[model samples]
Target chain A: MTATLTPAPEKAPRRARASSGASRRRDSGPLERQQSRLFWPFVAPALLVYGLLFLAPIAYAAWTSLYRWDGMGEMEWQGLKNYWILWNDPNFASSIVNTLKILVIGGVITFLCSFLLTLVLREMRAKLFARSVLFFPNLVNAMVFGAVAGFLFSPDGPVNAVLGWVGVETPPKWLGTDNVFTLIMATLIWTATGYYTTIIMAAVDQIPPYLYEAAELEGASAWQRLRHVTIPLAWDVITVCAVLWTVSSVKVFELILLFGGSNAAEPPMQTWTTAVYVYASVFPTGSVPKLGLASAAALVSLVMVGLFTVLLRRLMRRDPIRY
Target chain B: MRGPKIVAAGVMAALALAACGGSPSENGSAEGGGKGEFTYWSMWRADEPQAKVIKAAIDRFQAETGTKVKVEWQGRDIKVKIGPAIAAGKAPDLWDNAADVVSTTVVTGQAADLSSVFDSQVPGEGKKVSELIDTKLVDTLPKDPSGSTKWLVPYELISTGWFYNAADKDLAEQPKTWDELIKLCDALKAKDKPCLASDGELMWENFLTLDLLLVRDNGAGTLAKIFEDKSGAGWDAPGVLESAKRMEQLVKGGYLIKGYDASKYPAQQTNWAQGKAAFLSNGSWVAAEVSTLVGPDWKMGALQIPPTKGGNTEVNVSLIGFSVPKKAENPEPAKRFISYFIKKDNLEKIATEAKNITPRADIPAPAELADVQKQLSSNPVRPVLDNLPREYNQKVLFPAFLEMWHGKISAQEFVAKAKEAHVQYWKTAG
Candidate 1:
């Protein structure tokens, strides 16, 4: 999400230099001048809308984080004490660790699977149909997955009943606290890999078919072709995908919240991400709402997303490869 | 082509800007109503039995008082909406919720004192609303900031206990002590039946065994005090430690139904109703919730947590009650309606149609809840956990017990971790 901010600075200087070169030539046409004249008028509305709808809420959240308000009473100045509470909170610490696990561990597995799927898929007939089949899960609501998992993995549900039929009397508890996160990560990867694969495959399609033909003619293996051609060609899309995953992984809430169909109360602390932490703090059942504490947690997550987005962009920056 | 595309883009941007500038219309307006009416937001959905009972009462209340009542059937999480509404100075004239939730969400500033409503006589009962309900149950309602003025007038009561199939003659014998309870578990397990069924993901359902153990053994408010202790040393109390040890026994003894620790809400409890298990530790509402699952052959019965030495015998109760917000434009009519609500005719539906316990001791309970109702009558009542702070309950207390329940740690380890969390909480919370 923070990638939206990084591109503007990089593009501004290049645009300025091009316009300066055009001015030096004194060759600007009536069309170019008119377009320039319309630019501000065209863009002003979008900028204003973005400022009000997007940036203003973030600023308001930052301001609210410094006060101790429960949404009902007078706002008492809490300053940074709310953040201090979060820093000391063991639950909050685990929540951050869980968020990072989704970003790093889940990211690696998902990207690797997506790349492999994209490569094999690029060589196949009916690849479009296969890609659509793979992407089907992305269209389903997350609550459906959570509910299906509860049914499939219930103690005496189908999974265990099948194991019992096989004479394996004791199946591991799939939704146990020790195992729930692994299941969640696996589900996330299963649903996400297809999306990344589709995007990378779209970029891969733009590469000349002769590039692969030429590689194969020179005795290049599939792995060598993928390494030398496919990845380099699709690097731009992959970079965007990584940044998308980072932001999304940090914001993973509904799957974990409704995991195991346990929405009657808060989900297990073991499954909480930063998003879940913010939500639980604000709308806790049988407890007072802590808007200030929730705002602090939310700001911390926003900063994490910003830092990670910038880091990913810098690491992935490369000279554009022309076909 | 270029000019048209640019115009289209500009129009889209303008439309987006217009969309951003529009604000949500104020909804469920609580004031500026016709003179004879007031607004109420309820914590029950329109289709729920509780809502039906209340709807009936509203019709009767309107007929008797000639005052109109507008109700919005906000579901269980009504507090989420009520918080912002109260903050915006648009709170409904009256609302109802669990005492602890109402205290934290509305009573802090918005709840009007309802002590006067308590003293006013009911139309046909020839008694004040306060006189109708047990004084013990009345004391459990949330009060104003002054600590002496009452704010909530409760109509329904919920208490937790072990619910079982009364038709199971072999399980008819109730355990009088914790050891006997374990013996019964052993007997059931020998017959290939689990003694208890509990959902692991719902932290409160899992925590109930410990909560009841601590409260029933030491007294009500024991768990609350342990949570309030800033030093985190409260876990060292004999009652607290002993409760943990008892929970450890349930885990080690394998008394919980297979996969109880991994099942979801209504799953394990449904299993209990299906006769896969002999007992379910849950609130009184479980009978109503799983009534469909249990066939005609099955009958529901409840047993209190077995008492211990020096234990308080009083029931630990939670009240779901009505409160008039302080900014209410028609507090008198709302209060008057509440008095009518507790009348014998209206309150009886809570027990009959809703399958819940009514706070009015004069009203008989549903057949399934007679034991729970009898306990409420015979014993004085105290609020559960004395209304423990939500942060501590959810963040610190629940995880500690959860780890123990998952069998990753022993009872001693549970106490140690809980104590550490308590100390860390205060260090930052201070």
Candidate 2:
């Protein structure tokens, strides 16, 4: 190892001393040549794998969307017909609406709760423990929440029992067709707010304590210090968090599926998101699956995520505060 | 840098191994066709009573033939787990599922042709396997619409309709007609109890109510025609609107137990068993599902809602059957097991141990379901709405029917929406 390494350094000096004009003008090191030779070998395997598993499958789904197929049998060319059907489908349209509700409405409520909690938790003892408790739901499988929601909200469940104890005889039906989606959105926000708060708090902690001290010295007040010093420094992270929530919210399925009951055939159409729509289109109980429509719905969801991500980054972009 | 390079190489090796499907998923197959090791995937969970009886049967088969049969209890996730495996051609030698298998396996075609298995006689039955099973189930076994080829060995039949508490001594004898059923439901309502306790979220439970009404008002032929006629005409057949109206009357009259629409399934069943409500619309499986909850001697009875105005006794029946994957390497034993399964004695063991009905005609119905079973048997069997295009019942009829039951739509509106959904489904699924 030493001999080979010595030759590269030694050759560089001798070549520099012996060379005239052209050769001396260009000093190409052996190490640089070695690195160039090894680059593709280092990168090609990961690139090939990513292409096969991710890119190829995505491309195949896109191509498959052009045909009417049942995950089996002959593929009939439907061209734009599947997408046309999706456009006219009230259920699909409603599903997209539900996805947006969870994305935009659920996002707002989750971040609002998170930012409030972060402000208080920063100064509190056992703040780390509270953060862990808040983030615990993410560790459990989401279907557990769905199943628990079913039992908790049942007419004779503990939630109603509490209401009864409070002398409210007629509690609103929490799992009714009208209210189940609202409960789902609420549950998503509660479970998700902790995770983003943890991230935002970490970014806020990275902001210099001196910045807050200076603001306090100038009598900027708590609200103004938060508005100017803390938020600006955390703007870049908040953008990433928005993109993360947008992607995750649209993919919500298990909670909604099990919210009404752990074993209902499917969640009511009133609660469906694009993810649920895609799954039901492909594997609806007792019906012939529509794979082409499933692919189209999936592609639409991908477009939604892509569009939101770009918008989030654009809107949240700022001149970096280097404090 | 060296550490990252090592990690990258490790990941590359892992991906390559995964791409190659490391170590072939070999389920043992017979070498020359005598008896060999094979695998069976059952939908029953390990703790289920059916699992024990099935495992005992497998043990008996293994002891007799020296075959090492691997039994995997997959519960409901059996399909979800083995669906892709079957497509990848790694399905077990013997898997029990049907109908849902059609689009993925029976047609495309991943399932073995079981017509010959049907031809194979049940031991000591003195008839072909087809004759021993309920004729309705045999007829209802889904065939490739493109052509006729039997793909399932019909085994268990669960009769669908309403269940009543035998414990309610004041409960009168079964109604003889649709008007009588309405009278009975309303009479129960007058006494502050509804005639039927239902889980409205389960669309099929409500759809079954419509099916029995349709059958009594229009014979089985109307249903068969309904399947053939994709136009709104099929959904709007002569008696269809009237039956929906009759059902709408019961819904409007508040004859169903209060809060039916909000109740989830099994919760409704459990409530019925608990005697919180008088009657439940469910399948024969209700007895076995809530047997413990109702108490051993508590005794429950089933009654199919009677026909309308001296109408015929046509009733709905569903079949639970077995099928083999085309990729199964040991069809010989799988075929043998299918035959072995139908012997009146082995079936009786399943009935006695699992406490569920088997398809053999010779066996009397289990005590809980005996009344409904007799009603189901008195006439020729017909498929339940489950046999309809799943989209028709699930997407079209279900939502529409549920809305009407919720009193959100009129029976006339349900008919219109069902027709529109039918048109849309035919246009796309075609």
Candidate 3:
């Protein structure tokens, strides 16, 4: 199973390592020798399940993508025509653009807020409380946040009420049609930052306080210590967080969908992500349900995730700094 | 590990090779005849009186025929559950559903033609089932242009209208003309209140208003042309523009509830129920949607869209019908049950107890919907929103209407843009 489905990232550096490390002699341990004998049966059940459940379906999708099929009917073979339709579809294009905006723009804002919070939270008296409060959003459903945002940002909602009480009377339209997508992004960043901050907080705690002390003794400012000692130490966790954020951003559907609290069966297409696009195409609300189009979109999304993950991993690769 | 992975890869590769040949999906159904326990999937919720009456009928059927007919009260998510089962060829024997059965179930070919059941007599009425129902409904379920089969059997009939609170000893302010309607809105505006509390987020509700506008300007037939016309050239006709101007006036004239576009579904309806707004444009079933909120003595009344300057009142009528799935396990019993259930006495129970309008001509509409029913009976009936193609309604058309509501585009711009979009759609369609 691993031979064909071995993730491209795993294969990539392995090929380069095998080629470059030709002179390095390896010694096999007794446990490694013992493990090789048991590997087949040990992996057999899991491999069977994964292949049948995960990879087989993906392969089936790849096959089905070349056809024009309504789920309960005959599939007319249309090799690459379905992909052409997807490319031409303004909704699909917007979904892709919306997805990237969320991934990159939302990612930047989230990391910025999370890093700042992590830094301030380290010295705060009620650090645990602050962290927990920040962490609470991830535990709550995104739809709940969406609903709350709808209530709080209505024309005469509390946000506007507070703004009116202050000097600035003209509060922006938070739930307006154009503003909703931006609101959804802001919500995503607001919710996601807390989770990442908690993670980075844990990673920061793992660093020996003595390093900070040493840097301080060497006439390093707080910023200097954070840059040289704190960040370098937390680099591995941050990279992991980056990959996690990227995947999560793509998977976002419910929050954007329920944003501004639409009672309509289908939300406006402006806020749709790739996942929503796949769902809307296959199990459509308005148009004919095209499983072929859905399958093709899914394959495209998978390829996107794969490409981004490879790029991220390659860029984040560094020498392990043993503390 | 390598074995399963390689096998998986090889299997997919083999499938890829086979993909070029175009394997046709086989159509098969277990609908030959009836045997064993029969299952039904009703879209009605269990708490509703429709469910109660259906259950009583089912009990009686089981008692008489000694056939176990299991009824499942599937909620609004009935379509969601039905979709996979339809694909897997495990469809239920009977489904009582669809606001528009033609485009949804009929074209998809999931619903079997039920013309054979029309002969079954209403149990005690001594009348044929077909004779009791509205022929418009009988004529409405789209059939194959080449075939004589009817795809759906019409059940309860629902009329669309405006809902208002009558708690203050009845509304003496029923507007019967466009001038009277505008005067009504202006009066409410003078009182610093919104007369019409409609949810613009859901385009169907908004379209109901637009439909009345279209039908009112010219006639039902003219509006139907706009819906049927593929090129969108007919959209710029006088009647449509008049309706768009009316919509523009409604939106730009400060008559709608503030933040109506931003409000969620049912919020506006709820606002009407709470007496926050003066009126809500909705269907006959509006009472049931907000049944829990209204008090025992709560008075709910609906008014048909008043006559336009030149056109007569055209009421939006819909047939809430049942269709036998092609893959039904027990078509015979399902047919018998539908016949038994549609009997005058049984259907009258739906009216008296459940507060619904039956397609059976003898049954009076529930008192709450008397005015709406009166209007529906008086006018030329059309399928809600002229039965516009669902694709255009949901994607292109609804969005255009939404943009206009959002104040992003003007009414003239809406028409021009829609015409352009329609032209683009035809090019794509070709």
Candidate 4:
């Protein structure tokens, strides 16, 4: 019995070796192993959700654009007629102009304010307190902020009241007239500065303290440090933010809807961005449903957004900087 | 690692559990199945006492039918909720909406055909709907320019006219003619009170008032021709131009409240309610809204805008209504509910709760609505606003009227612009 047990123990090593060899063969190459194990495990679920929720819907919208559908009836194929109509539509042209204005003017204003705010926050002695205070507006929802902002700039609101106290007889209507682009841009700046500042501040903070010291030793002023050291180091983050802001600003609806200040359909038609125009086409004032036209409008807007994203990406190409 | 993975697994399990638990009634059946429960969504807010009344009615209905009912308050913004549901094929079984909305809802096939339901429930079962609602108004619904009855059904009837303070003895009692109304404005102006306080943001209301003036002066057929032909040549008609000229005079005469261009409907209404202005053009619904602005002590009266020749003639009424979806899950139940809800007793209940006028001719007018009914009954009820095509309403008419009101363009210029816009709208819309 002792001899048999000893033989069994000796054979266990051989069996273990054989099993280990087979397992190694199963997991031979890094790429094949990753495909079998890590790739599907890490990526499949997210890809499935994204494809189902977003990509599929976008694909469907693209398909729908080729047809004239009134939402409830049988869809009729219209080929490129809808697109042809959109090309000549004045509202579509105005929407494009308005979107670009928001992107360029609003983008520049937000970027400058955010960068300045970050610098101010970083240089402040009470950094934590200052940063918290600066970042507070980011916590408030945009819709709520829009309401509060509207009240502040209303004809008889506190801003005008303050202007009254200052003995300025005529205060321009912030919400009225056709110059709503200015008001919208100002709102965008006010809303986005804090959030972008936080993002930029993180990028700014990641830079080594020694870089600034080196700049100082090289006889650089504060301005020079920002221009030469800070900005260059934060270029990647700034570009990313710009790209994000461009996409988001094009899709802005709630603020314009709420504070575009009634008589929404007519003049100051220039105030309507693509997103607002699309929304209005879908759900116009009063009670006329134009579902087919609205769907067509949405398709046009998607194309515009896609074209814009590609153009922006091409224009804003920058090497990723290692800090 | 094993412990953390177990915690992550537990979290995922919890999320999965929550998701599974969320869809308890996807099949539209109420829990317990002892009694059938139906859900009703309304534009009324939860805080409104009317919502409570609606809930009470639901409860009463449930008790009578041995089915449970739930009333959900969706607030005044119906578009946000209803639009999506209509798109998704899950719209509410019953809803309250303006008559204009019914036109679009019907055209899009979102509204259920209630012809049979109307026959079974309404008192005048076989009567032509045009006889109940103004036939001319039914003609206004969007069609292929071939005149089709795309939609029909009205729940409430409201008329737009000038409402004035009853206590203000200085204000003339319901100006009978355009000239007399202007004279009244002059008198009010002399008394250091504004003759009219209006919300410019509601460009449509002001335009409707102007349209009514045109109708009264040019005869009712003028606007109908314009809508039918999609031309502004009708706008340049002698009586129509005169009406625009009259509007300009009123604006120049300082009859409107201060900052009229910037003010919204609520603000203008409040201004009138505060007695800052002696008159306001609005619907009968304002009686309730005004009571909230001022106190119950402020007595109110309505008057049809006078005709051009000082005659007690043309009167127009605005109607609001409800429509059922064509693809409703429970069509029979939906029809029964709508029919029950619009019956005389039910109509009175809703009117009392909503503090608005009921459309049913059989029901006696409530005390607050009696004056409006009396004024409107003397003349033919006409749905002026609803009698125009969607494109005319949105593109040509409203924008041009707004420009005219803002003093940016003369009435002639307004007419020219309107004609161009009308042509453009018809090109696509037709």
Point to the candidate with the largest lDDT.
Answer: 1
Per residue, candidate 4 scores C-alpha lDDT tens digits across A1-323 of 22343455557777999999798877688866766688787898999987765555555556655766544445678777667656656656777787778877888888888877766776779877777777787687767755675457656668889999999888875655344567767777787888888888898999999999999999998878888888878877887888788777776766666555453343335467766655555555444544445556666666666677787665665445665
Q: What are the per-residue Cα lDDT tens digits for candidate 1 across B128-222?
A: 88788777776765556777437788889998788999889768888888888999999998998999988776777667778878876677778
Q: What would the DockQ be for model 2?
A: 0.16
* TM-score attained by model 4: 0.82
Looking at chain B only, the TM-scores across the models are 0.90, 0.87, 0.85, 0.79
Superposed on the true interface residues, model 4 gives a C-alpha RMSD in angstroms of: 11.7
As for lDDT, the candidate ahead, 3 or 4, is 3
Clashing pairs in 4: B43-B75, B112-B324, B112-B325, B112-B326, B176-B306
> Candidate 4 at B423: error in angstroms?
2.7
Candidate 1 deviant stretches above 4 angstroms: A1-32, A163-169, A260-263, B1-35
| Model 2, span A253-310: residue lDDT tens | 7687777533427777778888788777765655555767777778777777778878
Give the best candidate by TM-score.
1
- Each model's TM-score for chain A is 0.90, 0.86, 0.90, 0.81
- In model 3, chain B matches the true chain B with a TM-score of 0.85
Q: Is candidate 2 or candidate 3 better by lDDT?
A: 3
DockQ (C-alpha based) per candidate is: 0.35, 0.16, 0.25, 0.09
TM-score of 3: 0.88
Docking class of 2: incorrect
Candidate 3 stretches with Cα past 4 Å from truth are A1-35, A167-170, A260-264, B1-36, B144-149, B166-171, B221-224, B292-298, B424-430
TM-score for the first chain in candidate 2 comes to: 0.86
TM-score between candidate 4 chain A and the true chain A? 0.81
